[model samples]
Target: MKTYRIRKPKIVVIGGGTGLPVILKGLRSESADITAIVTVADDGGSSGTLRSSVNIAPPGDLRNVLVALSDMPQLYEDLFQYRFREEDEFLANHSVGNLIIAALSEMKGSTYDAIRLLSTFMHVEGNIYPASEEPLTLHALFEDGMTVSGESKIAKTRKKINHVYVTNTNNTDKPKAARKVIKAIEEADMIVLGPGSLYTSILPNLMVQEIGEAVSKTEAEVVYICNIMTQKGETEHFSDANHIQVLHQHLKTKFIDTVLVNTEKVPENYMDTKTYDEYLVQVIHDFKGLRDEGCRVISADFLELRNGGVFHDGEKVVEELFRLVFGAKY
Candidate 1:
């Protein structure tokens, strides 16, 4: 039988944390080529414990991304995400997937290889690349001359963040992306930046030397997904424009070609603070500032409240991303 091959649009999605998986799940439903470049600077919770013990690239975010794009059964995915709550001392609250990634990383000699192997085993629909092959440490410089050495500690300070950068954990050297990550950006039709923490999750990937430079110089249309609400410690009282401005300042260039902002009003006292305590307030709008920086702002009712938390509607955001990708060709 003569078979026809499909040509999927090359889409490069960046960032990590809880946000990347939401969008990835949306994109998984579409017939498109996706390459998720994830942040490896995570230093909290289960990821932190693993990183501190075995020196693997914190696998929590990557694990979530892997499951998000996997076509496996729900049982398998759940098992991978399942955390140990038993009386096991070393494995308390650690995920099965994280341990698997750590094991593969040690066996394969790098995180890149481990992820590639897992992707194939999971029958993942898209590519997942770590921002760098080696484990990275995130360092943030605050506006008041305070510097935080880890991603976990940066937000706790609740101080004004000036800029953030990453270095390979074993040596004092500038971190660089794998060649695959660079090629993915160079060839992508569209590059999506956010829906994650500004300072901790998103910028860490861009701060890598080659990856940031590629993002700045790539001809692809770069899009930023504005968060629905301000984070307590990282982005307290930040406006939509403030988020984009911070990215511009860090990259030292106006790389974002477009921004997706939520316009729907968050009802007062609608969110249960006890359930979702990380959120502070709705992000204020600054349309003038967004336009001044040459961003094509597309605002809509992108807000969706579920599980007592406010989030960007992945379906709506993906629809806008498709529109921008189609426009970029013309």
Candidate 2:
């Protein structure tokens, strides 16, 4: 593990889904003050069910993040992650952590407060914040000008996405970041985006008005860990630069300062498509396009193929992140 002499670099990681936890888990071993701003726009599976019933921000992402950063024993983490068998009608498919989060949200009267309380109990080393105080409905406008609402349904449409925005689920009001979310972005030495879904997981968090504004103005080095694979419903033929382009288009600013791109190739017929169907192909690299967008590209063989799935080697990514952080500081 690498340590900082003066002060630990503050890293604010923004995005949701399975990818956020991967990055957080790696960051746990490094000497860094980490804060994760996870998307709450999910309306699928257990998260969606809880959001509809309890009216709290989706807890699935938050739960995963908590587990990722927790210093608790493996058994405790396993217990929190345990999901009920589908045979149990009332508790079917609900993770224990999600249920706990729901109960806490009800007891505390807000999801944000519930998470803060849970952080203490879970022994999470860093901050884990829901992107918004209220549940948000993600709306995507496709290239064909068709607008689709709900994160769960957007990809199902298989339409080309033009842009996406969020709205407070309960009213017409704009969705606001949970307290301190913007402050984390402002104070961060570096802001890391993605290794997750472009439209659903990553963009939804940035779509929060204040969060987007803060990112646009923050002096921190904004780094995008471009996805290893183009998503089926989202970025079917997208190059690495296309991913960056979408982010810039959504925020209406060229805020990203650096991009991490994977150069290693996935061996032919290595991925099990049946298990990981959302991914289409390796994200085509467009170095010129990335340079055109004014981003400093860091290309490497940061690949981790596990159980026939392609993922970012978290430790490798963290090594590069530390180099960037210390390089910028010194």
User: What would you estimate as the lDDT of candidate 1?
Assistant: 0.90
CA lDDT, candidate 2, residue 124: 90
Name the candidate that leads on TM-score.
2
Q: What lDDT tens digits, residue by residue, belong to model 2 across residues 59-176?
A: 9999999999999999999999999999999899999999999999999999999999999998999998999989999999998999999999999999898899999998988788
* Candidate 2: regions farther than 4 A off: 1-4
lDDT of each: 0.90, 0.93
Where does candidate 1 have its weakest 10-residue lDDT segment? 1-10
**Which pairs of residues have clashing backbones in candidate 2?**
none
Each prediction's TM-score versus the true structure: 0.96, 0.98
Candidate 2 TM-score over all chains jointly: 0.98
lDDT of 1 by residue, 1-330 (tens): 211225667899999998999898888887779999999999899998888788889999999999999999999999999999868787898999999999999999888899999999999999999999877999999889988899999888988888998989877777889649999999999999989999999999999989999999999999999999899779998999999999999999999999999999999989989987888899999999999888999999998888778888888888788778877864
